[model samples]
Target chain A: MTHTEAGRYLRLVVAEEAPRTGDTPDSGARRVWEIAFGLAARRRFETDSPLAEIGRTVTAAVRSAALPLLEAEMLVREALGEQVPVDGIAESVRTAVHLLVFARLADELALTDDELDSLIAQAEELAAAGISPRSEPTGVP
Target chain B: MGQTGTLYTAAGRLLLDALGEKSPARSLSHCAGSPGAVRLLRELFTVAVRRGFVGRDPRDITAYVRDLLDYQSLPAGGEFARQAEAVMRSVLGEPEVAYAVSDRRRFELICLMVGDLVRPPGVPTGELVALMRQAERRAARS
Candidate 1:
């Protein structure tokens, strides 16, 4: 997946809530994780928000979405500057965290549509610059 | 069931030490080198999960671990969380997940979770001891 393709899928997922029909499942899935992790790297919680508070927010959002709780824990840890072993986690769990975490961070930050678009654009630039690999998305950080 | 001699003693000692320690996770590291203690801890962990969490959704284990980490002020994700969840689920009949966790970390996680079964104002000591005794029997038989 090229950087442009990564950006396109990020828009598709965030805007349409799923990938479009023509997108290959493999590339689409990879983009989903890449975009999610990239956005997480850019997310900024409230300055006063403690780690426990961030954990609660992430956990509540994940539980409400009916995603796996372990996924929520992983997301919280990642948001707190921990290097989570995404490769070792189950794909289904990773995908769920990807989708839910992207949405939750967006909600938490209350980004306007234009701002969200800009974030995606920045991610695309970062991806193109090799912040993350095209063949394997390791996240934007 | 009768206790299995030294295994029972060692298991009970570990549990008590964990319960009494201000920093159980840190203290557990000191005992991680003891193969016998590690084996007993795994058996006790399986018994604790089976007794405490069976018949509930597997997600409860995740929630419990989250709460445990929160109370201990430990970071909640990474390889430790993944391996910890896998080890707990392994006892709940999904044995394959256990293979992904390393031996040392697995032993430490077992100690953490098994010790968690009797946190303050949590499970009564007598009941926990009985549960440990049951695990001892299961280990002896196997």
Candidate 2:
């Protein structure tokens, strides 16, 4: 899929304010995952807050959504800058984690609407520029 | 056995200190600066979990972590909870999950679990020390 198309789909998934139609389910799912991955790549916990504490908040949020314990742990680790092995995980599970974690992270940071829009815009710009979310450098070592 | 002896002694001291502290898990943070101390603590943690929890339901470990965190008023479902479960499970024969945890956090978790193993009215100090030595010997032979 073209980066522009992917970005549009991502914006739809992140905002979820409008119905998304047109892209096939497969392609739509992939784009949403990409957007979640892109958002996660951005450092959302670099403030005075401890990573562990942030991880707890994110984990609690994800678990409350009824995601299984292991999957919730994986999402928390990924959000906290750990390179969790996702290759073996199911696409559907990975997608859920990505979406939930991305949303929880936004909530945790208390991002203003403008800031959220800016981040989505940045993600769109990167997508349009052909940047892969996986290639983005994360803050955690 | 010599290295194990030193580790055993250090583990015993740390456990005692943790048991005495009102906030046992938080008290473990002091050893976070010393990699050597952390390593000893990790080994001690492995021994403690193996001795105290082997053959028990893995879910019990999860419940135990939840209770431990709840007692301390800490959040029970984040990195700390995950790491605590992973660390215990690793020692329980699922070692790979432990790799997902970072060293600093892993050390912190090892301290927390090790401290939990000795929380008041839990394992007696001498019995716990004996278990550590026996486990170390078995591990060395293998």
Candidate 3:
């Protein structure tokens, strides 16, 4: 349920289900990014126009080491279904997705409690500073 | 994952690769429209279901569906939405009344249809599944 836990789950599932070298090639991280950005967009802007609020969260995620700025922006654009060119951001996007969407997908996939905890210990090691990739704007406005 | 599920995953991957090679457009959307393509897809699904690839594991089915949708680039709500619906009704044999379901169900059916397109003839079902499981186990460690 935590960010690190989410990251690990994303890593495992992507590795298992979306292996890098395959015919149906994919970037698991990109898929993760789409889910997170998509969820955040839906929550904040479902009723009124909150593009600024969404943009700020996105800008901050990009500003942080959690995700690259342009990649995060393009992901937001893609989640909105824009057909923009997002070349060279796949790796960065995947890392961000690893940080953001794991917990959310756990619920959607009905993962078991044990499965949810599968990589928590390893994930905790990655975020010793306690900062996660949730779009909460760590130090930027 | 069970041996059966793992095997199906592997077979599914091979079928997906084969589809890309054989199809004119390298997409299920194109294949769905052609009568010849539909027959080929039906055969693939028959082989998979008979071998217990799907229907046994929801997770397996879910993963397969996601991959198919992504690979085929078929949006849940897009130009091909109606095509997906038709495929579901014909393939799953849902009652005519069930045709008016939500977009989400239609999307799920489309994913199912796409996943079923990876049909390889003459290969022993048990052998294919076993081979995929072995490959999966090795891949997990690497």
Q: Compared with the true structure, what per-residue lDDT tens digits does model 2 show for residues A85-131?
A: 23345566666666666666666677776676667666666655665
- Candidate 2 chain B: minimum summed lDDT over ten consecutive residues — where? B1-10
Worst 10 residues of 1 chain A by lDDT: A132-141
Per candidate, native contacts kept equal 0.12, 0.00, 0.00
TM-score of each: 0.51, 0.47, 0.25
Query: Candidate 1, after superposition: displacement of residue B136 in Å?
Result: 1.4
Q: Report lDDT per candidate.
A: 0.61, 0.60, 0.42
Candidate 2 vs 3: which has more lDDT = 2
Leading candidate by lDDT: 1
Task: Write one digit per residue (lDDT tens) for candidate 1, span B1-142.
Answer: 2345434566457655766787665676666677655666667778888988888755466567767766777666555666777788778876655665677678777767765765677788677777778766776666
Once model 2 is optimally superposed onto the true structure by TM-score, how far is the C-alpha of residue B134 displaced, in angstroms? 4.2
Output candidate 3 Cα RMSD.
Answer: 19.6
Look at candidate 3 and tell me the lDDT of residue A56. Answer: 54
Model 2: residues with Cα > 4 Å off, grouped in runs: A1-69, A72-141, B1-15, B34-36, B132-142
The prediction achieving the highest DockQ against the true structure is 1
- Candidate 3 regions with alpha-carbon error over 4 angstroms: A1-33, A46-51, A97-141, B1-142
- The TM-score leader among the candidates is 1
RMSD of candidate 2 to the truth, in angstroms, is 14.5
Question: On residues A1-141, what C-alpha lDDT tens digit does candidate 3 reach at each position?
Answer: 554433544545534453344333244334433454354444434322343444455554444444543344334544444442344455645455434444333443455656545444333442453433334321111
Badly placed stretches (over 4 Å) of model 1 are: A1-141, B1-11
